[model samples]
Target: MSLLSKADEAKLKGQLQDAVISCTERCLYSSAKWAAELLNSFPETDDDGSETDVDSAMSDPPPPQTPTPSSKDPIEARLEARETQKYLLAKTFFDCREFDRCAAIFLPDSLPKTSFLVTPSPASKSKPHGKSKIKLGTPTKPALSAAVVKGLSQKALFLSLYAKYIAGERRMNEDSEMILGPQDGITTNKELPGISAILEEWFSGLANSGRKPQGWLEYLYGLVLAKGKNEKQALEYFIQSVNCCPYNWGAWQELSTLFSTIEELHQVTPQLPQNIMGFVFQIYASQELYQSANQVHNSLAQILDIFPGSAFLQTQRALLYYHSKAYEDAEQIFSELLVANPHRIDAMDCYSNVLYVLENRPKLAFLAQLAMTTDKFRPETCCVVGNYYSSKSEHEKAVIYFRRALTLDRTFLSAWTLMGHEFIEMKNTHAAIESYRRAVDVNRKDYRAWYGLGQAYEVLEMHSYAIFYYQRAAALRPYDPKMWHALGACFGKVGKVANGIRAYKRALVAGSFYDNNVGSSFGSGEVSGLGGGVLDPEVLFNIALLYERVNNMGECAAYMELVLAQEEGPDYDESVGDMAGGVGVTPTTSKARLWLAKWEYMRGMYQRSMELANELCQDGVEVEDAKALIRDIRARIESQKGDSSVA
Candidate 1:
């Protein structure tokens, strides 16, 4: 090579490094590829007789030489040294996990000043003419070489493909964060299969070239497959990654997550770096493996020295505490995080949850409103606002927020269910039914939705439909007394006496009629308005009527007595009870007591019936009927005495 050529090559290599650095810092993939083109302008000649010595190439550079007598030129060796260094620097950045930096060098738009060695635009190339034309004072630019054009194109293609693949892996975290509603519209156009195919092609090329993929390459390929939902295939590469480099924390984390049990991960846990233990802890905490979660957290805590001033770590610790139901600890940690960065939306979201669990609605609402003002589009903020309105019994306002939340994320099952509840509170049975059905459609496992559906149907007097929904709800929550009670009432309405009686008995045995263990995404807390009379007096009354239908007067009388006793007790507070859905429970009044008196007479308990009738008359209820019954009984008694005397 000539001195002029060697000098030009060295300058071009330096420009390539600058472009790479600039593009990488900005994460400009396409521009970085263009930068890579400048470095790849010249081909490196490999000796077929010997293996390529990558280490020697990276460590040593040819010294500047004087003129030599041999055919081998000193300038050529200098040119080769610049080429090797340029290539190695790219690889070094990639291996250091500075991918954006490495990628920037390969992008097309990253060039600060165009180099003569880079591929030139076809429009910029001037065609030869038979006659020379007069030129101005401008300097002439050199024409691009065919080899340089082809090499740049080849390098650019590979780099662009690699950048696209990296973008795909990045989308995994983006998709996760989107579902979490921390930000909006972070989704990219790259599909998983397309990216995976590109990665496989690149990896295959490396392997075919007698080179193994780097640890990060394998780890990123595994991420693509994992994101593509090919976990089984991903696992192989993930294992290969850690095998290639045990310090690959990402590989370790992915492997740890795939392990079904905490015991399965124990083998690698001790080998995990302290910084990576946070990811392992997240896995355990998310899966509710509390024992393993606690162990991992304690180990991480020791490593972080209790995270004295790191708000991020402190917030994570608080969430773990919240998951473990150490609400007070969670509250304190969240408070500290908020104090450090009071405008932190996530901290506010979590702090609101802590307040909700403590039933501090005012504070919960305050935090929720603040969070909403910060990020109105976030589903958690919408939910917090909705929940506050619900607590205040401003159900219409609550529904608006709940619907807004659902609009943000339709798959938010809790929002759907809560919306149904708001409709029910408004007594809009049809709308409630539709909302509850949507909840069930979103998640059939949500028992609250099923119960809401049942209640809505029951209100509309669609007894058969009510029975169907109640039965479904009961199946999911077999121990829920309210479900069984509602089922029994529906059966009675549809004239299924035997089924009604069976369901009523089940209701009685199911313990409390109210479900206090209401679960929510934020956390579990007490539910209100579902409790009034724990043992519904109306259910007993329905069972009594069902027995009376079969002339089982003894059982009927027994149940009627239970109803009366309940009505008279403090446990059966009438003020809180709502019998809006034709729940078959009537307020205990003169009419209810009179029905007991009539049933006693029908059972042939004449003397007992007479006593009850007399008491009813004295209480100034059904006086005419009680008096007429007494007169008839007295006449019958006199007739019987006369007959006995004759005999």
Candidate 2:
């Protein structure tokens, strides 16, 4: 026997038959008018038929078949047929919106009778041949209207198909096939033709209907299209929405975002809403879209009819100018901001920087002081104040501020470095070294910290440590001539003469002139060993001394000659005047002239040497040793010439 009982199987068969009959009748009725319309619209050709042929085709007769009820009651078959006809009529009337007629069809008098039966197959001997079964009472109709029933059934079928599609049943083949298939002999295009036109028509209808879309639906729909599948359609929708609601910030915001995504913000920046101008400005600023940002700023300024008084905006504009190296313009704006808002820490900080750029240390100090009054706890402000004092050579005060800055923020490397410099100026070598080491620890890349450490070590006679720091500084700032010069000096202090020479050459190439760091460069100071300071005379003399120490005697003599030629006064008179003032004293001009004479005589230039000696003797100011040496030289010249003008 089958898994289902015979009675159950019969009941299920009866329901299935009823459903099939109902569906067929509805399909036939709906198709009738649609088919007629298709036939009327069908084209006539020689190969096909004329209008009369089409009309005849529509009116063609169907051959009748004799109704048969096999093994079932005749009343049951007739009732089922009548029920199917009622179902179809109700569906048609409901589709045409004839609700009353549709409701009457599914009333209590119209339902079909249901029956149960048991039957045995020809191959199954265990079951009886057949047993007819029928309900004794008439069937009761559903209270709901036939229109509602038809709609519910259609809705259920559509839902089932949608669920299957979502579940990936048949791989989307079912939906695609049915949607593309012909309906009522009318062929449907596979791909949507004129979809754009359809959408335009829908939009036009919406506009003409004057129905306001609720909430942000209209905006959201436009936004989806704008960012989703069709940007042009989305734009049209957005424009319509904007026309409907001019103050809609959402539409404007979405439209602005769309412009940014496509990098066409320049075109849309002017169209942004005034209320959300800040957000638009932020986006442009983040992207570093300066030209567009400026344009937007101008437009916003006009719209608001007021300049932004926010210190932040002023600082931002100032920073842009600073980055472009427009120091004057940056200074003007920064100063204005500081004046307007005295408590703006950033403005004060930037003002200090601008003053530094202008080389106005006094102004920098003033701004730094102003900043400190507002925020005395700020380490950067304290450091700036310390820098100002340090530049003025007020090491004690500089140290106080620097130490205070470091106390507030121990990681402030600039303050640490400034403190180290103060110690160096005060000749506290060990303290300077400690401070510089702390700076290096705070910021390993601080080249000035390493250089200060080197100088402090050199002052303490720790040549090796000095050399190490100098090397590190050189590595950090290889292009700095001062670093090269410092390295050379460190090498020289450590007795590395050859290395020192090489370093000096590097310093020369790096643009460190001999007089750059010397005392004479600032005047009123004594330069030991070289005998002159920063003056041209001192530099030439130092060059001569260095050459002589290196055993370049000819070079030493040549530089000495250059010095003598450039001297403003007579050599002997200048020597006398220097002696009276206790400055640049030479033992005797006669002796120096005699040495020069002997040097020229040895080089076979006797006439030149004799003339130099004569000029020296003619000055009438000679020492006893110089006079005796001159007498002996005159007797020797008389003997060589055999003149016999005996002395």
Deviation of model 2 at 639, angstroms: 13
lDDT string for model 2 (314-420, tens) is: 56566655433356777888878767766756435445545655667777877877877878888778877876776677889988887777656555666777678
Lowest lDDT 10-mer window, candidate 1?
A: 521-530
| lDDT value, candidate 1, whole model | 0.59
**Model 2 lDDT at residue 538:** 37
Whole-model lDDT values for every prediction: 0.59, 0.50
| lDDT of candidate 1 over 242-265, digit per residue (tens) | 554433344555664455434545
Clashing pairs in 2: 520-533, 520-534, 521-534
TM-score of each: 0.45, 0.36
Worst-scoring 10-residue span by lDDT in model 2: 520-529
* Model 1 spans with C-alpha error above 4 angstroms: 1-367, 373-375, 391-393, 426-431, 512-535, 567-586, 589-592, 603-607, 610-647
The total number of steric clashes, by the backbone 3 Å criterion, in model 1 comes to 14
